[model samples]
Target: MSTEQIPEGVRLAPAMVAGARIYIPEPTWCDVDHASENASCVQDVDHRTAPAYLNRPGSDIESLLHVEGFAELSGAHADPVVMLNDATAMHPAQALRWAKDVVAFAEKVETIARSVMPELEA
Candidate 1:
């Protein structure tokens, strides 16, 4: 038999917050008919995660993930894109917000990586 590790080189650290639910903060929703059918395919996470980890004041992605929301959400679910659109329809503001969030998040991550891996300068 084979066993799999959680993949974190570092053990679970205290005071470390997981932002799994922030990316998709809207609650488990139903289709227009208000049915839970479409939601079945989506995995439901603990409700506590959103309130505790998500829900930040910053309008940008860093504000959205200043505490590591991006990492957790990506790690937690596999098909968030499909799930997000399928879960519930988003308005224009949602689209705009997401775009801004992603751009800001990418810039910050790139900056951090460049700092850590100075070889990027080459």
Candidate 2:
């Protein structure tokens, strides 16, 4: 075990989103498609709205850019409703695939910590 891995005393914590320490989730917004799906009385209505106003735009890590992430990775236009439905249906199988993903992600994190902040490896 690395000696530096042990904490010697109290230290200030990392910066966090404002008000997040209270444990309340931030107010969320949905695209028109999601909003209509939740707010509508019809269960089988097709969501055929323009893509411009349908989903939040940006990178996934920057925010929860649902269909945007898929579209970016896939280099194609996205259908927000169908993509979300697929995600929900596939979530269990998707989570099971983490058996391989977690090892790589954890190793990369530890490698960067040991390289950039050697004190953390002590």
Candidate 3:
């Protein structure tokens, strides 16, 4: 760890990367257990939220999502993104639009469900 003073409002933590100690900016949303010996914190790498599982009403199928935020350090992209499992990444605005569309689709599904099962109207 460097003796350099950490700036106010900024948090830096030391991590071992490739067998060398380095400092990395820690984000508030980062839930990584840095105390663990296996912790890996690399600069320019993304800090991500805990995986959230999304499941259908009555199915074994499910999906996972995570919101990842990156720092501008090392010339890496600083934009925050929503990642679907390991396949897709979307900008915050795109994620919001997609969420709105999902809401609308869910409403349509609810309407169809109610029509088919009038008991659901209760």
Top model by TM-score, which number? Answer: 3
Give the alpha carbon lDDT tens digit for every residue of 9-116 in model 3: 446765556566666766666655443433333543445667666665565565433334333334434555677665577777887898898789879988899999
Error of 1 at 100 (Å): 0.3
- Mark the regions of model 1 whose C-alpha exceeds 4 Å error after superposition: 1-85
By lDDT, highest first, what's the ranking?
A: 3, 1, 2
Q: How accurate is candidate 3 locally (lDDT)?
A: 0.60
In model 2, which runs have C-alpha deviations exceeding 4 angstroms?
1-38, 44-61, 64-91
Better of 2 and 3 by lDDT: 3
Report the lDDT tens digits of candidate 2 across residue range 1-122. 23355344312222222222211111122222332233222222222223212233564334332221122102232222224322442233463474357568868978988999788844
Question: What TM-score does model 2 achieve against the real structure?
Answer: 0.28
Task: Give the alpha-carbon lDDT of every model.
Answer: 0.34, 0.33, 0.60
Question: Any residue pairs clashing in model 3, and if so which?
Answer: none
Query: TM-score for each prediction?
Result: 0.29, 0.28, 0.65
Return the TM-score for candidate 1, rounded to 2 decimals: 0.29
Each candidate structure's count of clashing pairs: 0, 4, 0
